[model samples]
Target: MRTVPKSYYKHFSNSEQIDFQKQSSLITLPQPRAHPFVPKDHPFFVRTDLTAHEMGPPKTVRTISQEAFDEVVKENMEDLGMEPTEALQDAIQTLSLQGVDLSGIVKCVPGESSLKDNPLIQSLERLKQLDLNSKDKFSDEDLNEMMGLFDKLIELCGGNEGSVNAAVATKNGGVELVCSICYKMRCGSKRVLDSCLKTMALLVHDVQSTETFRTGGGPKLLVNILIDGNEDPEILNSGFAVVAASATGNEVVKESYMELKIDELILEILSRQRNDSIQSLYDAIRVLLTPDDDQVVASQVYGYARRFAKIGIARALVHSLHAGLSSPSLISASIALKAVAVNDEICKSVAENGGIDALLRCIDDSGLQGNKTVARICCSLLSKLAGSDSNKSAIIENGGMDKLIVVSARFSDDASVLQEVMSIITVLSLRSPENAARAMEAGSGDLAIQAMLKFPNAQQLQRSSCFMIRNLVARNPENSFCSVMVSRNLSDRQRRTTKSARMQPLMH
Candidate 1:
């Protein structure tokens, strides 16, 4: 009874194994569970159904509200006993350090006297508060206040802080406000209009403000001002200043002004003997005609330069170079002439208008007065004009070679002036062996030798002298002989100097 059979035990074991398999099939394994506290969109949450590369929720950007900024500034003002402006600046700096986005926040403090803390803001606020549409005429007080505000704006937008202040003024609608004020006062007050134009000149120095000026019809306003204020020297000066400032490096503004026939206006204005605005007018012309690195804009500017020549701007510039013109005006006119002499036709136009003779006279006078700057610019313009065969002939016929030789001798110590003189000689002797012979005879070879010997470290001057020598000797055998002799002498002197340097070390 105690001994059970092994087969009976084996059958029980098989039955138990089959029962265990059925139970395991009927039962389900528990599914993986996520933490209860973790949200579905949390970065830590992993879903098996989704790919691993799914992006997480977007980050929140830190920002400060106007009220929050103002409260902080107020706290700084009360607790730290800081001035309102100081406290405001400190608050901006602190929040900025914390990576707070301060865009759209009013930069000024709140209060009836809020703007009084900042003159720039105060000026802008006062200008915006003016009701130009409501009144056809402004009293002396209103005009005076407006003038003061404009002057303040001008002061703020000039000098080392010009870029920053101009940006701030543009952001505060200073450009549009001034343009509107100018429109209302264009036909009203000369004094106010002049101040407004001057202010606009500085305001448009900012890039965004220039765009605002152009889109807001500032160019048209400026042209009208020039036409109506043609008789007023102050208005013309300020208006031309605005043109110069706005047209600089801005092709669209230049095209806009050109479309309005500003060239004609400038020519007409230039015809007058208004000495005060001559510099500004020339500056405006220079800026308008000057080309940048952009090929499309440069081509358009070349067209404008041609148009200026057609409209007698070259003659006008030549006229400005008359004997009695101020040195400043003379220099400005020469610079403007260089900008206008863009091509052969315009260069010939400049030459045909006595540009050569005028420039020669300027060189003589600058030499007599020891004015190297004037001479340098005159030589530069002469070189530009000399690019054309016809103009080069005109220059040589006008005693240009003798004038340059005399200038070089006079300012031999001035490497800058000599470089310019050498440049002109280089251009004059470009392809003409006859001109090269003439330059050699006129002491140009000696000038180059002297320049190279004197300014050994003057890289540009040395290079220019080399070019001059090459041009002078490239076509003429006689000139080449003289240049070789000069080079031999220069080499001998350099050898002697080196010998002295080595001997000095030995002596020591």
Candidate 2:
């Protein structure tokens, strides 16, 4: 007999119970299917037996206010009997180790005023507090103290954050203050004036500050400095540096300087044999002569260059390139020469004034001394001078091709110098098959191949080398065979090292 559960009978009515009994006797149920097996470590497997209490409590985060932190520092100083600075440092270290953000925290000792909080501001305030009645009334000690303060300000303004410091200083009237100081001490001592000029140079780096300086008679003041301190190299260097720094990219400022006859003044300085201020003097001239993208400014700059050339600046530039000058001075002079050589006549004049021989000697000397920068600049100047037909003949006649190849080999590791050298070769071999032959004979083809192989990543060097090879092989068939052979060797070397197919066209 089959028995029914009492709970099943409770769900049926009296009349439905009879029908369910008949149906239950005929009904048949299917078997249950088996479940798939899953490993306990599988991500989808859940532990149904675990409870929330077994997972432990959540982590509690604690935060402290600035006032509370200050109280802790006070306790460290009072209870532990530590120095105020020591106490502050210890509190900062302990909190920082615990992953606390300590930004916006003042990092100075306690009880110091906010003025003393920043050294730059403190220096500015000290300078402002000075009583500049007259230069005569100030003692030597007073002047020395003022110079020291200025030096401190210079140091502050010459850091990695110098631009920001300059902005802050300008906002606080630093430019006007320095100009006032300069006017008061213009006649006092050369050392003070030098420092003041240098300080002003660093301050007027931005356009706003430069405009302030320009509007506040900075150009006339610097011109006075140049005129009064012409015999003093330190004063002249600082003065010219200010001029260069102030006039960069500011056409209005440049016009103001030109109006004050700055070009004529610089020519007068360059006429002297003093090598002390050569860098700053050349830098100032380069900045003034350099034109912006505006056509009007460029035209004005062209006229300025012509005026400079007529005033004997070419001879002065050539005169400064003597062998006795240092590498830095030589580099500056070469750059200045490149800038002023704006025309064929100017270029020819440079060559006529012993420019070729002087440049070759510089390349040789600087290459031997391992001063690659001087060598590079000399090669670039040679390229610029090679624009003229007579200059090209002069450079070749003076063995410029051989000198360039020698520089190429010496500075094979330097992509910049090699680029300059190859460019000069390209310029010299523009139309003359004779110069092309001279270049190949001087081992320029081999140097070019080596440069292409050594600096595969230097796109400009690669382009320059290809141009050089093209020029070498374009007119002179004899050199073409040599270049093809060099290219084959480069191909063999390239096959061994890298599988890049880009060098194939360049090689051939």
Across 1-508, the per-residue lDDT of candidate 2 in tens digits comes to 1222233332335655555444433422222223233222221112223233532333222233445466656765675565677667766764443234444233456665332567777777777777444443356876788799889878878888777677667766789988888887778888887898889998898766788999999999889878888888888888988999888867778888889988777878887746544478888888878885252524367777777888889778888787534644777888888888899999999988898889888898877888888888888998988878789899888878888888777888999999999888888887788888898889887887788788878888877877777777766767657555555766565333322212322221
Lowest-lDDT window of 10 residues in candidate 2? Answer: 38-47
Model 2, runs deviating above 4 Å: 1-116, 131-142, 275-278, 292-299, 324-328, 490-508
Q: Write the per-residue lDDT of candidate 1 for residues 1-508, one digit (tens) a residue.
A: 0111122122124654344334323322223244344222222122234222222232223444445666777765665565677667766764453235565355775453453566777788878777443365677778888888888878887868776677667766778888888888877889989889988888887455678999999999999988998888888889999999988777889999999999989888877755544468888988898774253423488889889988788888887777523545888888898998888888887777777888888898888889988999988998898889887788888788998999888898899999999898888888787888899899887776677778888888877776677677666767656556465657564334322211211100
Q: How many clashes in each candidate?
A: 0, 0
Return the lDDT, model 1, position 207.
52
Model 1 per-residue lDDT at 253: 90
Candidate 1 segments exceeding 4 Å error: 1-116, 132-137, 274-276, 293-298, 324-328, 489-508
Native-referenced Cα lDDT, model 1 = 0.73
Sequence-dependent TM-score of model 2: 0.72
